[model samples]
Target: MDKYKQYFLKNIRKKLEEWETVPSISHNEVYRFLHSIAGTASIIGFDEIGSKARKLMNQLNETDDKQWTIEEVKQYLFEIIEWFDENKKDAPVSFTDKGNKYGDKPVILLIDDDTSFLMYMKEQLEKVGWYVAAIANPQKAITSFYDVRPDCVVIDIHMKETDGFAVLEFLKEKLKQQFIPTIMVSVDSSKAVRIKSYEMGADDFIQKPFDLDEFIVRVKRQLERKKHIDEMLLLDELTHVYNRKYLKQAYALLQSDWQRSQEPFCLAVLDLDHFKQVNDRYGHLVGDVVLREFARFLKQGTRVSDIIVRFGGEEFVILFPKTRREEASEVVNRLREQFECHSFREGGTAFSRTFSCGVVEITDANEPLEHWLRLADNALYEAKENGRNRVVSATPSQEAVHQKIIKIAVVDDDPIMRTIITDIVTKLPCERKTKHELQTFKDGVEFIASNWHREHSPCLVILDGVMPKMDGLEVLQWIRQQKRSDRYKVIMLTSRRSENDIARALELGADDYITKPFKLLELEARICQMMKRMS
Candidate 1:
């Protein structure tokens, strides 16, 4: 495929050279040539070239046959020709990961309107183990900032859709109380641009076409500072885990994720049993020691994805993402047994301590984020009432499972993608043991305006990011302004691999985001996983 692109580019160059040697040419001929190239480039997945060709074609008269000088022809095709000549030596675009797993890496949000620059910069950043969320649309940058919570931000000043300063200004205001590092980048190296960037709250400013190594190092420096800031503000001083101050933000993040995927989680509240007696018998210093040791124990007992927060005094809260109630209960019971068997020693004195816990799974996803914690607290009260050293499970909602109508919407301009998604939605009913009413729309506008889409039922949207009318992101943002629930899920199906695009979709309330050319089995598994937590 790469060789084919190279061959075509070489053919284009040959054509251009042949035209230049000729005495004259017709405007209509040039238009026809550009039209052919536009279609061919698009077919070959060279979207940038296709777009350039189309734009140039619009300036040419299809019926003009007057002789055009070689100079005039060169001037007409100058920009695209220069672009082609410059990028001809570059490697083909790669969708493969190059064996680099960036899923767990520090995310850097790069906002630039140049598609080629976005692609190049993203690959370069990923090579250094940082995940780059390239936002080609500057208008979408601000909305994505909070969702991705990037360690570093890089914004290009010049853009077609929106001003980088405006985007930066919005984000700076949103993060005025926070310490996320933001860097402004532009081809302009003037003192004014630099000073204005800093004035707009940019932590750093770099000129475009600068050393890639230097850019990455500056990003690393910013991330290091962010880490230090997190240690001081986000972590509990004694336990080193998250503190109560960060719990509300964490809960909001978790709730946003749940709204996107209907993925369930468990919240557990734990209290040291007979903690007052411990302070009376062993003194405050020993009690503090026990608290610290118990925090370490809790951390060891839970998975890395789980969060433990020191709520207050001897009380601690645990949040388990994507965990079921029963599984969370079992984990808490095991941890309690192990903790009870451990001996706490101060000098020659030794004693055993126990903790009571309550675990609750979010059965109603639409409830307030604090509702889960409150339920878990109630269960903890039950644990204390029954036995001081035991884990009690919160009774789940007793609503009977009745036959319900699940509306499934597949919105994509591409017929093949729509067919694939509709098929998947069709299969989900049998696999999930539920009934589904499915609908397909070839355009975002059609789907949004359709009567079927307005039906009052639990809906699952398999939306394409790129569409003819309203884009998938726009539709997603619109849908999110309405409602959310355990039965409502929106999985974004897009060909865009940009993390900024993904974040914007999520920040706008998308339940899930799937890139193009994804495996059928993997998508099916994800849907299954989310569905199991729904009801």
Candidate 2:
């Protein structure tokens, strides 16, 4: 039998004998003792003993008759003893040696001033093949931890020279490795003590006279969880691909190699076609699944050397090392075909997926990173315009086409409403006429404060009413007071239908009032009319 199981059985027998003599013992006390035994036995793989102890504990809890005689208590204890004796012969193989499988077990530094109790725990833990360094002195524990570089530390809350809480504070300050998990073990079972231990940066806690099974379970669980968390930091939760953060780190190393070898590389940008429409029609949950499955397809289709990354929502970027434009185009073409054929099903409804791609080959030494990225982005734009679900390459002739500039300003407190207006403006012909420079402000106060100067002005201002910092009418009044520019025009965009709000905006020299969710064409025509008037 495992030594921990034997220890647990001994404790169970002791609790049973106590209950036999004092039949009036609180049910909670008896339950706690049996629960501890059951938890420990299960941890060490003493299934039979653990199962019987759990059943007896349940029976004790369910007995509502308060008038139980002493004879009844003795009979129950005898039955439990007999049950353990019968199952002891059939118990499964204990996990006494499994700790060694971890390969160079991490030393656990256990600090407790109770010398006898600390020794008992250390012996029990070490019997299961765990490397334990026990110390009755807090100062000695710190030295041992530094010498051994223990993976974890357990400190008792009460000690002679210093308390466990103090020792924990010392470790947190002195141990430069904050990632090391620390646990506090104490007989102080009060909620306040547990909360205080947590505040002191203890990862976990256990009451004194801890069940050996629970101790091992908690230790193993914490170590495994830490390992898994470290791995997940490198992965993107949405697409399950390596995130751009990881890509940037890996690209730095690859860039050095390219600089030394004078090798060529290609960077491709991929964007889902009409992805917003998918979110609008199917909701974000389905859209998320589509993105995940699409990412998986990209992973399966790409070469092992290629680095794929989720740039942001509905957009992905891939780095093809030592690949030329033609090779990258072939890879993109395959991916495009695969996506066109892919159908995602949500709630028994199927939807087809398509994506547009742009590729740029890094060949010129003078080309800046932003310049190449812009080239690819422009190519992607062309692909989207010329019926998406295709690939476009950056050509020198196409790169010569100048992007028109339009200076637009939006004043809205609600971020979502501002985004909606910005989206509409980006799709307008004015965007193509003026290479789009758009600015958004949360409130009218921010707009007036930032754009008070004559040189700092936008061609058109989309203003909102009923704002907290400053109302649209107040902003228009301020603007009229300054007489800043004749070129500037204001459009009042609001959700309010109040005639008073509309009349005030126009009375304060506002050009127009557009209600929420206004038609895109109407908004464009209104702006063009104002522009013509100014001209």
| Number of the top TM-score candidate | 1
**Tens-digit lDDT string for candidate 2 (58-94):** 6664334355455655565565578666654454455
Question: In model 1, what are the clashing residue pairs, if there are any?
Answer: 260-511
**Candidate 2 segments exceeding 4 Å error:** 1-234, 365-367, 400-535
Candidate 2: residue 251 Cα off by (Å): 3.4
For each candidate in the order shown, give its overall lDDT on alpha carbons: 0.72, 0.67
lDDT of 1 by residue, 53-96 (tens): 87887676656768889898888888778878886787366332
Estimate the Cα RMSD of every predicted model relative to the unseen true structure: 17.3, 31.6
Scanning candidate 1 in windows of ten residues, the lowest lDDT window is 94-103
TM-scores of the candidates in the order shown: 0.39, 0.38
